[model samples]
Structure formats: structure tokens, C-alpha cells
Target chain A: MKHTISVLVENHSGVLSRITGLFSRRGFNIESLAVGPTQDPEVSRITIIADGDEHTVEQIEKQLNKLIEVIKVRTLTKDECFARELMLVKVSCPAEKRSEIMTIAEMTEAKIVDVTLTTVTLEICARYQKLERFIEIVAPYGITELVRTGTIAIQKGSETMDRKK
Target chain B: MKMKACQAMVECLKAENIKVVFGYPGAAICPFYDALMDSGIKHVLVRHEANAGHEASGMARMTGKPAVCVVTSGPGAVNLITAIATAYADSIPIVCITGQVNTDQIGSDVFQEADITGAAEPFVKHSYLVKDPNDIPRVFKEAFYIAGSGRPGPVLIDMPMDVQKAEIDFEYPKKADIRSYKPTLKGNAFQVKRVMAELEKAKKPLICIGGGVFAANAQDEVVKLSHTMNIPVITTMMGISVFSDDDPLFFGMLGSHGVPAANRAVNECDVLFLVGARVGDRAVRTPLALEQTTKILHIDIDPAELGKNIRVDFPLVGDAKNVLTQLLERAKPMQHDEWLAQLESWRVERKFATAKKGTVVPRQFIDKLSRRLPDNTVVVADVGQNQIWTATSFHIGEGGRFMTSGGMGTMGYSLPAAIGAKIADPKRPVIAICGDGSLQMCMMELATAVQNDVRVKLVVMTNKRLGMVRELQTKGYNGRETAVFLDGSPDFIKLAEAYGIRSCRVTDDRSADEAISLLAEYDGIALVEVIVDENEATL
Candidate 1:
């Protein structure tokens, strides 16, 4: 099972390394992780997606919370949270195939950020499955390069991870 | 007043009430040492950088406070890694300060430059690499606070040479308040009530303690709880000194190499009150299986330790002293007469096989020595077969201490540790028992002992083998023992004498008795080399 772990940490130098170091040290594998500043400048939020059983996930959550810089940790499953990932893809394209790729991008709500004579670069921000499907349809166009900000999530409804447990 | 960053650092140490520091000097650390010269804080020069750390650990364990160790950059700091890791593993609080190359020299591969904070990241509770001189006082305060606080462990501070030379306003923080680092000290009222309810219902309940009990200085509170509720108590290896061997309510140490009664109590107990123990694999090999039959109520300072090892039915996160004190307040007398009797019945005296002629049996020797020592004696046991023998045989009565590198199981630990403990309290007798293999690892510490005039007793159990590994090879590897021999070992008695310390060699139990008396009665440092049968069992 896949679980999303959201952690609030002090926005200090090496805090990111400390969180990532903990995951590797405890033998927990991270499938995807996204970290950025929160509403409070003093604090940063890190979202980690990992695959583990219920017990393993619980252990991971506890271990993450053990880091001195870590302020709070909450683990949620995909069904309970709204998760999204951002991807930028640069695909090989001639003038003939450009319109065809644009239609596929239009269907997925992806934006064409750059247009070159032989390559078209597009940016897409969507759920993990939607991004994967978009990649599947555009793969035959000879994709040249791809980059992604791995999965980040927030619980659905009025629940905020910012509140103290 | 404005002063060098190094002066501010020394001032910080004085503010922490640190009267002594164990360290080895180098060019990078010279500025701090120079500032320390007039600060009235004593510095003991150790032979190796690592022993400085170990010695500080000894002081910390004895005083129940964070002790300090300092070393130079590069090799000096790198050498102290084992000691740092050792202290971290055992939850012994120590602040390790290392000098670094100039700020600009870092990452340039300049001479004597090491990223100590990066290297010690995983082992330390927290660490700092000071780039600005102004952060000196604050960093030192935070380092000490983090090191000595809840679930105590080692913390590191790496100061660059240029930064130490820069001037900074001297103002040490009166109190360290890290917003993210506040530890839970008191247990929840509802959880305490639940624990009480469980205790009321448990027929074959047992209390298991660990190193965290010592970390919290909660030995007395735990003892009170055990007595108040009439529960039998067992301890993990690190929890050795919490209960005396003669305590009627006390069972022996529990683990793979644990006392039969203690192991059986763990199996039979309906509710196991795990106080300050993580229940490592060595303590309970099959935690899941044990969890099926036993309802474990674990109270620890670190919440991460709650369900990390075994399943906990009642998890209480707080300091051991506070939680146990909470339990003591409303606790009433309860009966486990039948259960106690069952445990007592299973507690059989272990019989030792006869030793070869002209050789001493370790267990018998330890028992005799323990009896002869003073009540306040501190026994520092090094790793390997010697540790097992001492842990099983040493009688730590009231006021006595049992110190070891239990969690990390580091060899060559006892000598420096004994020196540290003796230095911490000169009146308390300190003895270090180590095997020849382990002794050779840090025998250079003899110079440290003699130079400092720290009169610590050394007991070398010379079995001419890495006895623990040899035993493992015998049992598990079809008796194929390779690279287990200590063929080129030196004469430890002569070695001690060369260092200008009194020394003796004992081959049998009779000679061991006289040597023990000499060790205990000697006004100065002494070394007793006890020759043991190579095939003697660890148990």
C-alpha cells in the first residue's frame, strides 16, 4: 500500500537532509517526495509518498516525527487526500507533428510553454494517474526530456496539517 | 565585552558548570585551547582522540549530565567518530567539539579540513557547523541542551578556524528554548489511569527497565513503583545497575544471553510494563510472538520508541521519572505471590564447567572481585566475552555502578571509561575489565591514566582469543574458527609496569583473590592480568 507522509519542519539549513537521512537510515524507501515553504516562513512542509504495509507506515511516521527539526507528521492514503504532481516534458517534433501533439496536450489540459523548429516543450500539473496517462499518449511523439516535481498532497475538505496534534 | 569566538566558547562551557573537559589538541583547535588555559576549566589530555570522547562519556554516565570532549580538525575529529557513535548508541549525553580548517578552506580539500558535522549527522542528536562568529554562544547552548535533554545522546559542534579567530560579543544564552525541540516530560492523565487499570487486572505482571531509566535518572522512582505494587522487575543489559542482585523483587538481565528466570518471566507475564526500554532484538528476539501473549505497556521519553520494536498496548510518552512518579502517587499495594514464586522457581543457578589447571574461571573471579570492592565502586565492562561475564556476574549493590558500551558493544571501551569515571569522582573506585583482544585496542590509554594520576583498576582477562566470536564460530559455523586467535598479544602486566603503574599476573582463582585485594586496596593505579582457559564459556 502507498501512504503519503506530510511533515512540518523548522525551515533551517540541513533540515531537508535530516529528513531524507532519516528515511534511508530507517530502511524506508521513498517513492516520491516534495518539499517547499509553507504559509509560515519559519516552517516548511515536506510530502513523502512511500510504499509500506500499515505497520511499516506507522513506524515510518513515528520515526519521521523523531527528527529534532520535525514539528509534526501526518500519514494519509491516496483515497483520503488530494494528491497532484507537476511535470515538464520536451518532445521531439517537426512542424508536421506539432499540431498533432498540441491536440493531445489540449485534451490533457497541458500548456505548450516552448515551440522550436524540431522540439515542443509542454508543462502539465495533474494527479499522478493523469500525468502517467498523458505521458503514455505523448510517448510515441519521441519525448526528448522530462522533469517532474514528485507527488505532493493535502487532505480533502477543511482539514489542515498545520494544526498541532 | 568583545572577545574572540574561542573565548566566547570557553565562557559558554563555564556557564554550563563544566569544570573539566577531555581532549586532544591540534593546530585547528589551538585557539580554543588557548582560551581555555585561563578559564579555570581543567583539561585532561588523552592519548587518542577517540578515548577523549569515551572518557567524556564515562563522565556523563557518572554525573548524569552532558560532558564535553574536544579535538582538532580532520584526523583528530575523524578518530573520535567511534566514541561519538558509541555514546549515541548507548544514549549517553556528550557534547563533542571539533575544530575545522578555515571557512574558505572547507570543501577545497585544504590541510586538516573535515566536515565533522556532516560525518556525525546520523549518530548525533543534532549538530552545528558555525559559519558566523556571532552564532558561537547560541550554538554552544543549543548543542549542550540537545545533548543532555530527553532521550539523551551525543551532539557535535564543528567550528572553523577563521570563525574561532573572529571577534564576537560575549553573551551566553541563559536558557535554551528551541521551539521545535520541547520534549514531553509528563504522561497524560488518561494514559496513567489506563496503566493503573491494567496493573490492577494483571496477575502475572512484570516490569522491564532499560538504559532510558538511567537517562532520566529515574532509578529510584522505578524501584518505588516496583515495591509499591509488588511487581517483579527485570532489566535489559543497559539497565544493569538499576536493581541490585540481592533485591528480592528483581529478576536478572533479559536478552538472548539473559538469565533463564528473566526470559521465562517475559514469556509468562500477562502484562509487561516496559519502562524506558526499546526491547531490541537482543532483548526479545521474537517480539511479535511475545506480543501475541503479552500485553505490553511501554513508557518512554521518545515516542518513536513506543511501537518501533514490540507492539505496545498502552503507550505512554514522557520522562521515565515523571511517569513512574505519576504511577507511584496513586499506586497501592498489590499481590503477585504466586507469580513471584514461579519466577523464583525457574531461577536456577548456572553451573560452570571445570577450568583447566593453572587457569582462572572468569565468572568465579568476577563474583569474588565484586564482593571485595567497595559499595561505591564503578565497574566498566568492555565488549566481548568479558562483557557477558561481568554483566552476569558483577553484583551492583546500592551506590555501585555498572557502565558498558552496551548498545554499540564497542571494544577497548572500559579503560578510558574507567579513567573518565574515576576522574569524575575521585573517591569512587573504578575498575575496567577487558579481554586481551579488547585491551590491545586502546592500551595506549595507560599513558592517559598514568599521566593524569587517575587511579583506576584494570583487569585483563587474557584468554588468547576473541572469545565471543570464537564461541559463535564454534556453535554456528561448524566449529570453524578462523582469525579468532590473539597470537601476538603483549604481556599486560609488563605493559602496565612500563607505564609506571603497579601490576600483577594471576593464573588461578587463589592468585586472583590476592590480586583483587591489591587492586581494591592500592592507593595508586594497578593492573591485574588474569589468565583464563581459552575455551571458557561466556555464560
Candidate 2:
């Protein structure tokens, strides 16, 4: 089962190491993790996608909450979250295949960020499954390089994980 | 007027009311040592860095305050890893400060540079790597606050050499308000009432105590609740000394090495209210027995501990003292004379096995010592057979303390930890009970005891082997003993004398009384080495 966990932590050096160290130590398989500055400068939000059963995911949530730097932790079900992953892929493209590659990029609503004589770099920000399908379509053209920003997520509604006084 | 970062650190220690520091000095920590010279904080220079960590833990356990340990980076910091983890496992609040290489040279593989914070991340409650001098006061304050609060544990602050040298206007924070680190101190009224409602109807109720009871200073409340509700009380190994053994409702430790009566009570109880215990594997050797017999209501300060180990029917997240107090208020007096009588019968009928002649039995020796020691004495037991023996047999009186490496199960913890306990409270007698193999691990701390004039009695159970492991090997491998014998171990009495402490050796049960008296009557540091049969097992 796939679960998305959102962790709010104090913006301190080595805090990330502490959280990731816990995941590895507890043998939790993390599929992807994205951390970025939040509205509060002193706090950072980490979105982690992990593969585990319900018990394992609950253990991870409880363990993550035990960290002193961690302020709050929430396991966002698919229904209550807006999740996305951004990927930049540089695919091998010849002059003749450029139009076909461009059409595929357009169909997926991806942007052509850079282009060279033999390569076309495209950036796509979409849901996890959509990005996976897009990558599958481009793989035939030969993807020379790719980088993913992991997954970032937010609660869809007014439910806020703000630090309660 | 600028001050050195080390000076600021010393001043912050003073502000935190840290009068004693257990530490060792080295190149990276030179500046801090220099500043400590005139800082008025007494420094007990331990022989090994690991001893410093245990001593600090011992002091913290005794005083209910965060103890401090300072060491240099690299091997010095590495040496304290075991001790730090020991404190973390038992939730002993200790503030560990390590000096690092200069900030610019940190990643350059400079001399004496190691990522101490990274190494200690998993075990420590929190860690800091201070890059700026201005963060010194805040870091120290936060370190102490975090260590001493919310299921207390060890915290580390890695001070870079340059940061400790930088000058800044220092102002220690009056209070630590870490916005996100608030711990729930009071139990929710709804939950408290719910527990009370259940307790009112419970027939065979039992209260299982753990280290958190002592950590929260709720021993009195635990005793009061047990008496008021006439509920039986059993403790985890770390929860020793929380309840007096003489109490009618008190059962001994409940776990793998626990008495049959305590384990039986755990299996027979109807409502098991666990206060401040995590129900670890050692404590719940047969979880199936507990699950089948009782519905567990776990009250703990840390939410992470609620459902981490076992199934909890009800959880009241609050400080043990506060929650226990609330339970006492709403709870009505009850009588379970039938249940109490059943437990008492089991306690009387199940007697531990006695030792054969020619062997100085560990349990018999501990029983005698328990009878002879003062009511306020503190017993620090090292790991292995001696620890289990003491836990099962030794009786702690009111106001007495019993400490051990319950979580990490670190050997060589007794001598240094006893020294720390004695230093924290000189008015009380402190004893360190260790096995021969365990004693050899950190016997160097005998020098620290002598140098500081720390009057702690060192009792080495000289079994000539790692008795516990040897017993396991004997049982599991069909009596094949491997690597369990200590053939070249030094005589502990001679070792104590080498450190300028009085010493004696006892070989029989007849002489055990005299040895106990000598240890009790002596006014300064002393050691009593008891030679026991190597074949005798802990159980």
C-alpha cells in the first residue's frame, strides 16, 4: 500500500538527517520524499511517500512524531490531499522526430524547457500516475537523463496542520 | 565587552544550576576546559569518555535534573556513544557537549573532526551543531529544556572549535519556548473519568509501573493509588524502587527474569493499568498471556509509546504524576481482598531456588546486602547475571534508589553510574553490583571514584564468566560454552587498592555478612569482591 505522510519540522541543520535516519533504521521503504520551506520560515514541511502496510505506516507516523524537531505529522489519505510530482527529462530527439515528441509533450501538457539538435528537455508537473504514464510514452524515444523532485502534497480543504498553541 | 564562546557556555551552565560536570578533556575541548577552570562547576574527570556519559546519567537519575558531560570530538565523542544510548533508552536526561573541529575544516577531513551529531542522531532526543557563537546561549538552554522535558532523554550539542572561540554578547534565555515542543502535562478530564469509571468496576486490578513514574516523580502517587484502590502493583526492571517491596499489594518485577509471583499476577489480573511503562519485550516476555487475561490501559507522557509495543485498550497521554493524581481523585475506594489474597498466596508459594554449598549464591548475597544497607542507599547494577539477580532479589526500601542500564543493557555501567549517584547525593550510601566480566569493562572508573573521593561501595560478583550469556549458550547449544569465560581477569580487590581504595574478597556465604558490614561501615571508597561458582545460573 502507498501512503503519503506530511511532517512539519523545525528548520534546523541535520533535522532532515534525523528524520531519514529514523526511516532507514526502522526499515520503512520510502518511495519518495520532498522537503521545502513553508510559510513559516522557521519550519519546513516534508512530504514522504512510503510503501508499507497499515501497521508499518502507523509506526512510521508515531516514530516521526517522536522527533523533537518535528512539530506535527499527518497521514493524508488520497481523498483528502492534492499531490503532485515534477520531473525534468532530456530525451534523444532527431530533427524528424522533434514534431512527434513536441506533440506528445503537448498532449501531456508538459512544457519544452530546452531544446538542442539531438535532445529535447521537457518539464512535467502532474499527479504521480500521470507522470508515470508520460515517462512510459517518452521512454521509446530514449530518455537520456531525468530528474524528479519527488512528491509534494497539501490538504485539499480548510483542515490545517498549523501548530496549535 | 566581548566574551569567548566557551565563557558563554560556562555562564549558561551556571545559569542552569549545573554544579558538577562529568567529563574528559582533549585537544578539541581545550578551550571549554580552560573556561571551566574558573567557572565554579566541579568537574569529575573520568578515565573513559563512556564513564562520563554513565556518570552524568547516574547523577540525572538521582537528582531528577539533567546532568552534563563534556568531551572532545572524534574518538572522545565516539566513546560516549554507548553511555548516551543507555541514557536515551532509559529516558535519563543528560546534556552531552562535544567540541568539534573548526566549522570551515569540518568536511575537509581535518584532524579530530567527526559528525558527532549525525552519529548520535538516532539515540539522542535532539542534537545541535552550533555554527555561530550567538547561538550558544539559546542552544544550551534548548538542549537542557529538551533533555529534561517530555519523556526525558539525552540531548547533544556539538560545538565547533571556531564557534566556541567566537565572541558575542551572551544573554541566556529566561525560559525556553520552543513553540512546537510542548508536552501535555495534564491528563484530559474525559480520559481520566473513563479510566476511573473502569477502575470502579474492576475486580482484579493491577498497576504496572515503569521508569516514567520515577522520571515524573510520581512514585508517591503510584503508591497512593495502589493502596487506595487495593490494587496489586508490579514494576518493570527500570521501574524498580518506585514501590517499596514491603507493601502488601506490591509484587516484584514482572518480565523475563521477574519472579513467578509477579509474572503470574500479570497473567491473572483483570484490569492492567500500565503507568509510564512501554511494555517492551523484556517486560512482556509472554504478551499472549497478558492479552488473553487483561485489558491494558496505558498512561504515558510520550504519545509515541502509547501503541508502539502492545495493544492498549485506553491511553491517557499526560505526565505520570499528573495523570495518576487525577485518577486518584476521581477513583473510589475499593476492596479486592480475594484477588490480593490470591496474589499473596502465589508470592509465598513460589520461592526462588537457593544456591548449592561451596558457591556464593548471587541472590543470597543480594538478599543479605539488601537487609544490611541503609534505607536511603542507592544500588547501581551492571548488566548480565548480576543485574538479573539483583532485580529479582534485592529489596529497595523507601527513599532508596535502584538504577541500571535497563534500555541499552550496557555493561560496565555500575561503577561510573554509582560514582555519579554518590556525587549527586553524598548523604546517601551508593553501591555498584557488577559481574566479574562486566567489572572489567570499565573498572578504570575506580580512579574517578578515588580521585573525586566519591564514597561508593563496589561489589563485584566474581563468577569468572559472563554468567548470563554462558547460561544461554549452555541451554541453547547443549551445554557448549564458547567465549563466555574470563580467564585472565584481574583480582578486583587488588584493582581497587591500585586506585587507593580499601578492598576485600569474600568466597563463602559465611563471610558475606562481614563483607557487607565492611562495605557499610567504611566511610570512603571501598570494594568487596565476592567469588562465586561459575556454573551457577541467574534463574
TM-score for each model: 0.98, 0.96
Cα error of candidate 1 at position B475, Å: 1.5
Clashes of 2: 0
> Tens-digit lDDT track for model 2 on B217-306?
999998998888888999999999987777777889988888888888888888999999999999997666677668889999998888
- What's the distance in Å from true for residue A16, model 1? 1.6
Report i-RMS for every model.
1.2, 1.2
lDDT of 1 at B79: 98
Q: Candidate 1 — which residues are off by over 4 angstroms?
A: A76-81, A155-159
- List the lowest-lDDT window of 10 residues for candidate 1 chain B: B347-356
For residues B1-539, what per-residue lDDT tens digits would candidate 1 score against the true structure? 79999999999999999999999999999999999999999999999999999999999999999999999999999999999999999999999999999988889989888878878888999888899999998898998999998889999999998899999989998888787788899999999999999988999999999999999999999999999999999999999989988889999999988889999999999999999999988899999899999999999999888888888999999999999989898899998999999999998786766778888888888888999898778999999999999998988877788999988999999999999999999999999999999999889999998988999999999999999999999999999999999998887777887899999988876788789889889999999999999998877
